[model samples]
Target chain A: MKRRTFLITTTAALAAASIPVARYYSNGKKNYPPLIMPEELGNFCEEKVIREIGDQYRKQVPQESEKAKLQQILLTDDAGKLTAVSDNAAIAALLDKKIQDDFNSSRILVLSGWVISVTEARQCALFSLT
Target chain B: MHIDARQLDNQSVIEGDICIIGAGAAGISMALDLENSAHKVILLEGGGMEYDDRVQELYNGKLTGHPYYPMKASRLHYFGGSTGHWGGMCSTFDEIDFEKRDWVENSGWPITLKDISPFYPKAHEILDLGAFEWGAEYWVKQNNALKLLPLDDNIIWSKMWHFSPPTRFGTKYKDAVVNAKNIHLYTYANVVDIVATDNVASIKQVTIKNYAGKEHTVKAKKFVLACCSIQTSRLLLASNKQAPHGLGNDNDLVGRYFMEHAELKTGEMWLNHTEPLSFYLMGDKTKVRAELAISPQKQKELGILNATVSLMPLAMSKNTIPSIKIWSQDDPRKALDTFHKYSNLDKRNYIQKLFSKGFYQSYGLYTRSEQLPNPDSRVVLSEEKDELGVPRANLHWALSPIDKKTVYTINKVLGQQIGAARLGRVKLYDFLLNDDPQLPDYTSGGWHHMGTTRMHEDPKKGVVDANCRIHGIDNLYVAGSSCYTTGGAVNPTLTLVAISLRLSDHLKKTM
Candidate 1:
């Protein structure tokens, strides 16, 4: 997408959201998407992760400080199909696949004209990796 | 699967204008720069695209100096080089980073920061971070709008930052590299030796062998070694065919001056702050998303040197679920629709909020300024050669006692200021003193590695020049954090990318 078009579309779509809309180019008056952040692999990476993770559990709850059970989940998918799994990779794979399929369905309609949904599953397609 | 030179029956010999050893960051960047240029570039990798178990095993060893992601942290054997899994946090070295600090030893770069400044933009554009431009002074947005707030230090401590698409070189740049016309980046051809002239000054050819027992000899007009620090120095130490000590170790400077970011376990918090920080958004780089330190007042008050902050989020920070906030429907931020996307919003705020209310971490680690350089902390050559005749690197990472003292002092002073401002409470762990049976917090390890083949203007003190060229060798070069004279408190990826682009232009002129 052209830079101008992307900004326009993103702004128009998100203009109705509850959050405050940011201006992309201050003087230029282009609107930016809102920032509604959660936990991201990239975020922990910026802060010394081990320190951050340890800090979240260790400092806040002195009672359970002795035992902090932090779990990391990593999942990989090839062409919308799961491929590999790990303890900590990225959160996209950790979130509900139903949501991913929902987002992707909208994405297909938005960009390439393809219609695929989570319910369009075939018994033969769900085979485990050999 | 190690190959012997005698099996060269079906092997190929190639000649080129540039022969790059250790196909890592600088090597691939050079090849990309010279993709269609006149320079005949040949990149040799000890580890190849087809994963070799042995090489992978060696790379899995503890990342002694720097902290990269755990699962993704593999000293890559693939085409894109170690950049395959790199988290693209790009920044350039400052002039102060080049100057020898009284606090640091075996320190100082041969080149000035100006030499690498020009290349930062191209790297930034390539990385896709237009919103957060590098080197450009911070800007503020007047009509700002976003779900997240600035990293107000009153609410959050270490704030968040950003980079472009955060390039994972291997995956992002792989297509252009594999199809390049002028660049021949052979995957498994690991260079064993830099066949130099009898005088031992000029590198003539490199002998390489792959896991399939195949041998290849490559010669070029210019050569570059851009492997990670330990390997670059190790390759020098192992190429003892001409120089008994190693390739560039006449003064034993090849593997010396290893630097990594050492982290301190700042004491934990019992209560998570109710409010989140906005400093990470305050910078002009991205949206005015958050704010932390680095303002004029704070810089002077804390004698603030260069550093970057990133606020981390906790599980409670993500409790934007409609179910959790069902009781508080009137809450301003209780929109269920926005809850899921909160992770994609300004993460720095989430961290500040999480720490404010219920969640907090025990350790607040500061990847402090480049610890004083010490020659004793060096990368040595291992007697054993891998599947490729390339010798392995044995990392002997030891730090100066003063390094620990600095961390302690930073914690004490910074913590006091934080508490004085009522930002957060501070705890100084007794890990450095006798073992603390109660609190086992400690200062240890570097996730960011740097300064092996350092950049220097003078040949006597450094290996590479301001342009990142080997002083003695005409066409040879080095790049990445390994070329950093000092590892600043911030991440090194941006600096490496910036310098690499600058070096590419330098090579362009010479080519």
Candidate 2:
């Protein structure tokens, strides 16, 4: 279905389901907009999830220097910093830790609320920074 | 005397000074208050003292919005009504729930918080709860270790809630109602129709039927519909023999304005310091649990709805990433089982690998927010009929944009509040923060059905007036959450019981 038809169908479904579709359909006339947009908000959520994953990964690795090195590499030029187009493979190549080989660029990920390819996540640092 | 309507003659006529339909929390509470009074009371319970599959089929209906619990499994049809399976989390509605807030559509009640404040203490007794205290100071004083998160009180504060021993009215007050000299308790009395006068201004009698081949007519000086929200509206809408539009439905408002306590897991909170947060935890001996609550002033300032958040440790929270998919299962119980199994496996793995590293326990922020009352969200009669021939209640449980906005704003506000306090960070769930927001699979309700027969002074705006009397009707009243004009973000039992007691007082004066 087209985007407009999709919204109309979804709104009709919501009306039937007892959800408040009017809030969105009203186009901010009565409903207030959030202080932050979806992607911005999702970035924070993604960062949190990735940080937790990193923390768990750190526990298994048992190397404090490796953890610090990985964090530092994510911010440096070698890690494809500020590149408009970057992928997981490019960033992983710069990591000093041998576990860098574990990087899987083609993997699909659901970060925060955004569904994206692993390569797309490299652009946002798993929603930490863009 | 306890009489079985099924044992009565086919056309038996029963008379009383006051007749209360549905012996649930509200009906039983009202009857208990009127015991040994000058006037005689008749209490009608559709089912027997226990659950009956045949009677429960009356609640079977279709769901049209977010997936809800099966209608049949959602509420019990026996004598105690829903209190039979209630979790007994009790708290009073905030003062704001009664006020006509500019932000909330169709908000405000004809009565103020103070109007029902006097009866809350009595209701506490009826519900077998602790004191009437819902303040932070009262609970904090009881347990010194209970320190609220050091957040700005003006923005957010601790809202205390007391748990009930979960008094099942069927088991708790059955004997008292059964033996009351002036109170007549009738079982198996399914009211098929409410017979109103030609003017449709007063209910002359109610006709009830039973599978035992007995039919009866109950007449009273006054009548109260204390059935649960959906059933109350169903009876009013189905009783169209006298009024073409059904009794108390001249405004087409009887079944409108349905509301629920929209419970959602909004985000995760990671405390930087391990304070144990013992006060917020459900203790074996403690009577209350505190949730981070947005103050009414903040709500008005921000144009948000009343909402509260409880913290659940990640180990126990059912919303973990690996298991949240289980919630999509059609059967809520099966979904819960799948979640538990997946969560348990995840928990065991994390404990094995991360326990040695002192991994900080993360907590999930469970949000229970108020739904802005919407006329479009309502209860309507379905084409399906039950064994007793009553049309099943087809529920259109819609959420308003304001309702979704409430969740998003509160989570966002909480994130900001936590960051500002330097306490910890809050990461809102992805779905809530997404542009095309979809309700997460885990979203459900507190099973608090309300606002079907909203109380208002104007007949056009409500099904019942300030006195709980159906507008333009001389003696018909509603005595449950169905009479609520606006539902706050708390369980409805305490406030609803208080409302029922207030109605009892009104009847005592008028009868």
List candidate 1 segments past 4 Å from native: A1-130, B1-9, B54-74, B132-160, B268-273, B281-310, B313-368, B419-427, B430-446, B458-460
The CA lDDT at B218 in model 2 is 97
lDDT for position B353 in model 1: 37
Candidate 1 C-alpha lDDT tens digits along A22-130: 1111233222111111121112122232234334333433443331111111123334544233323343334335324433333211001111122111100111000
Find the candidate with the highest DockQ and give its number.
2
Top lDDT hit: 2
Q: How large a fraction of the reference contact set does each model reproduce?
A: 0.00, 0.03
lDDT of 2 by residue, B1-511 (tens): 8998888878999999999999999999999999979989999999998877777777778878755666776778889998876767788888888999998888889999999999999999998887777887887887788887777788788888888877888999999999999989999999989999998889999999888978899999999999889999999999999899889999999889988877877777655544457677653355788888888888998898899988755433432332223234434345335434433222333332332221233566778898888898899998888888888888888777677778877766666566445455566666785665445545687788999999998988998999899999999999989999988988899999999999999999987
Model 1 CA lDDT for position B431: 57
Q: TM-score of chain A, model 2?
A: 0.27
